[model samples]
Target: MSALERLNGTRLTGTEEAFALHRRINRTATDYPRDSSVPALFAASAARHPDALAVVQDGRAYTYARLDRLSNGLARRMLAQGFTPGSTAGVCLTRSPELIVALLAVLKCGGVYVPFDAGWPDERLRGLLARADCRWVLTDRPEQLARRLGACRVLPVDEGVEECETAPGVEVGGDALAYVNFTSGSTGSPKGVAIRHRSIARLVLGARFARLEADSRLLQLAPVTFDAATFEIWGALLNGGTCVLYPEGLVRLSRLGRVIDDHRVTVVFLTTALFNAVIDEAPGALDGTETVLMGGELHSIPHVAAALRRYGPGRLVHVYGPTEATTFATYHRIDRLIPDSGLLPIGTPIQNTRLYVTDGTTLCEPGRTGEICLAGDGLSPGYLGMPELTAERFVDREIDGVGERLYRTGDHGTLLPDGSLVFQGREDDQVKINGFRIELGEVAHHLDRHPAVRRSHVTVSTERGERSLVAFVVADPSVTSASLRHHLRTLLPAYLVPARIHLCEALPLTATGKVDGRALLAAHDTHTPPPAAPAAQPVATRD
Candidate 1:
């Protein structure tokens, strides 16, 4: 039998039970509109709820009508400046209402939006702009960005600009490119994942994980640069819900709990690291939130079990996806009644998405381990400007006599007898630190580029329920951790920097002359445990 046939059968589980579960898995993949786009859908909501509060931040609010006018005005200005359907624009601004305006404006102008983190080092920011071929930037501090990025036009985004009461006359379809998000790449440079309008529209239309509705209120906690922000921003606007922006600074647990109660936010997404810490540092921190979505690495089942005991698993959702899949591909509403030992299922595919577990050539049956590949509407077109790399990762294969294109996720997993996927670790040198994906090869490449560095091998160390990056380096006598970190900051983003730099006379080598990372990790200088508390604060930055 074919893999799909085996997957559709009930051989492992009861016949009736397996078929019933299969129907439930594919239930959400129905009734999605093919022609709707993000901007178009949001506009419809705006017309229906013109007077409703669309966004709130720092004691300020913007109604749907007002936000529409602001974005329309900016879109008109962009069109006047010759921005066209295929043009790409960069938006560098702090987290504020202006950020939302810029996003909608770019989409309304029929241009692709590329978000920039103002907190990033200028060199790294410039590298992104150059790599994306973005010649226009929208920012409040136009003078600073203009002088820094020579030969680029910087337009100021502020309330003082002219207001436009009418919509911009441009045609945007679901097939057009919407945004490009940069993620850690194996080549030491960040790669931009190009996503389309239909991908996001499909995610928001019948999304059950977040349960966004006309009256739902969500906290916009994700940074604009991350793909998760796509769900926070558009998920609310398109659903006619209110989006409350979280303030900047490291998020204190005590304060976050208060904000949830104060704002009456129904839905929120926290990184798995933060969720685990909150379960320890301050129990019941998320009690006020109706639905909590956790992503970026798997959760500790014990912590999840405790939360389920206190609250319920129906309120906790495990959302799984990579940037290449446009935010989320699969979701599971954890079963609260189950025991918290061992691994939990990743659940089934979300709307318009399909999961296939394969062993290179054929799909693996239940109870067997294989590489997890994704196929469906949410898949990104490919990485930007790297055709060869894109071709290597995304490929077409024949399954059940049908030609289907699949993205090789590089992560391994197994299909349980009951049909849910149990996530295994990555097949490559990639790790998720506090929900941020880091490529060890990228980190090592940057470290080895340093003048004093001879060779570097980076590995992950988990101690006391925490994961951290540890770099083992053989360097010159004058090389220091501070110096290497300083050089790395100029080249790589802050999240990619290693937490520990071990200076060794020589890295352990195997008989085959290859660096044995396992031996190096076993002999690392530190055996002491890090603090039981989380390393970074969970604060949500506005920009």
Candidate 2:
């Protein structure tokens, strides 16, 4: 049978029991917490693969031995500067080998690092820096980034420095915070998701989703700021594997293919948007990749079908999770494509993470969509400094007769009879108009599914007490506002359809290549409506 046929119709490997076998293998607890100190995980990896390449960036590679040396020196220097354990530092640089060193250095020194999206505007950058209470900022040099980091100590990585070593063995327990990653919120605000050392270990250890070997090279495509990047960096480094951090423009199809061939990347992870881009535009570019891991927004899926036809089913593995549950909590090994919609099911939960589909406090039955609640060390410590907000979202719950706190993902999804999951949109991503709730993702999803549409975004606005639906999309050059609106009306209900359809060459994306909804929303000014066909493109092209 074709790979697509098996993925579409076959039962998963092993029996169809309910206890979640994948979860069993991944979530064993140690005598102490696993995440308490991630530096130790690094230590373990370094010890096993001391001479193996750890990080590769800009054509230069740093082996585990070098990483250990650099981390030690950086840690001591930080300690010399009066830095204490549990302190927070800011990391503001493009994805680079040096940035990887800096993160390890901070962790080794018993400090949590805040990786700011270097592509954020100066204003947004300043706000995140201030909120993190950062003691220092590391960057390439004294320019806009340095100025934006404010009064924090600035480290210029270009300057030559000595590599430091640990004092034989350094000890710290597992309850420490690893890092705080800031992400966009529904209410025009940003929230910092706090991950602990144990959670990181649990997440990686929890899922035997991929083969682990010292020679595996994970492609680092996500920006340093996003949680996806964190998974790429730590997942590879801690597993005695090498992390291949792709340079900036290399994110493009032709360029991305070049990087894969040049570095011989064994494992590659791309966001849904990126996966679609490569499949639709350059499916031939991925000649060297063995496995393609994906998440962070569901792809159009037809795109995945195309890739599967071109490259066998073994190449695609659909990954799903939010930052609230570490990098990812669900996995679907796509053996083949379905005829309708091609929606790949996000299969069973990962190790140590407990996922519950609940109507309220009660667990939901299979095939019912409900709020997704995650319980485990994988759950973050709630949004930073927002207790009220935290309390409302992160709740204490009892499952399987055990007590634990679960993070209310705010994401809605259903458990299939097969023990897989199908994601719906966010619970609050809905915008109310004329007393009716309209799902923005639903509109965007429909638009992008259109044959001509390359990408799309839908944002609602209220002016003078009236709500409006505006959409930005990249479609066939010939498509116009009227054509798209007419098409959307047929797919969605009148109320759910976009009122204004603006066409663009491409949509603005965050530093991580996730659509920058804020920027698209900003293009909608109150003075006058933007044309369904925007003449000017997005201000920035994110790598």
Candidate 3:
């Protein structure tokens, strides 16, 4: 039998054993039972650590006690308004402590917080509000938001909130909706993904619940519009961990790590691109900080190795999951990622999360490739208001007469010999070029594995009647587009090779920080002159 066949569930592979050892990342030993309610966890944490700081920004910090009050007042204010059970309240705020408080309040008011982006183009934002049928928006001033939203109601969250109703509102429970997150659609219109509170609780509460001390500071770098922001907000406040916020802007977050250190910040999560920036700009200055969770996109292992050599291991925690499955449902505790290990494993599924790789109808055995199916409390109800879309993505099957809904992660992977999953990106990412179906992630994987390419996005662009393969890459100072493409040709078939390679300063990212393939395609121009031949030195870190 191959080494991968010897494993069941999550056993270590021979290949993995050849590399560095993984630490105690899986929380199964902790015996922490997954809870069913999201609000109760927050309430319990607040009660247990009321005086602990829950959020911070530009010298501003909010304690759990304060967070409770703010959210309660806001909830009551929302209740005072006509926000009945299931009432859709939109929040168009940036990432901040108040944003969390506002979202929680909307939740407490027996309504769902449909997160809208204040930074979205007016047309996009308007389209989202209209599609969501958003009755009102919680803002500093609803009047302005109201004008843009048409007849929809606007409830100001910052200023004075209306009083709570004398009578209790709807009693929302596990299955009730929590929030709606919109993903950019291919057709230019965004698709709304509805998430239930059960999924939210599972991802946040199931993990080992460490007490967030009075001083544990977590920086809020993601925007509230993105689903991962939910983790930074809830993950901290629900643990009594202080979540520090950065004002919404185009500034690179790595630039502010020093300021975070100056404040004795303890923890912060970053998308891979942002994490690499900190590594390039200032590496060691981040040693004193606590956990640095990274996921959302592919992070280079060699780059991580260099960081480990410069700073230390155990500083970076690689997490993975789609917004469809809460912020992050899987994690790989990495001390170091060695090249001989092959593709990076997403590590193990978190607490209550159970992952399986199946070929549509049949669950594949170990070492076999299949689509990733996630079964757990973390799975969202599915796409919002898109029943056909929701039903299509969420597959319900009867296992021994018990029916359970499983999420098709759209990703494909092979069960590792070690029982950990090695991600292969979206199955749809696999496209037929020259009669052969190739996983874009596979080509991108080879690129990431390349010593010279720091990070890359592989895509197919249409030219006349042909689909031309292209790769937009951010690379080490030593690499070039020609060199990178040449490296790929050695491993992949000629037709699969990215004929046109563009050495980018950085990969474009969506608001949620995932690599924006469409955005790059839109911005790309094959006719443009090569960038004035950049010097063979460290270019300033790209955002």
**Best lDDT among the predictions, by candidate number:** 1
Off by over 4 Å in 3: 1-36, 141-143, 159-170, 206-215, 253-255, 398-403, 429-543
- Output the TM-score of candidate 1: 0.91
> Comparing candidate 1 with candidate 2, which one achieves the higher lDDT?
1
Q: Estimate each model's TM-score.
A: 0.91, 0.75, 0.72
Worst 10 residues of 3 by lDDT: 531-540
Better of 1 and 3 by TM-score: 1
lDDT of 3 by residue, 121-169 (tens): 4555677777877877877656667777776777666634333323234
Candidate 2, backbone clash total: 12
What are the per-residue Cα lDDT tens digits for candidate 2 across 387-474?
Answer: 8889998876544434557777777887776667788767466544432334576677767768888887788765532356788888
Candidate 3 global CA lDDT score: 0.65
Q: Whole-model Cα lDDT per candidate? A: 0.80, 0.70, 0.65
Question: After TM-score superposition, what is the CA distance of residue 388 in candidate 3 from its true location, in Å?
Answer: 1.8
Candidate number that wins on TM-score, 2 or 3: 2
C-alpha lDDT of residue 451 in model 2: 89
Quote the positional error of residue 123 for candidate 1 in Å: 3.6
Candidate that beats the other on lDDT, 1 or 3, i.e. the better one: 1
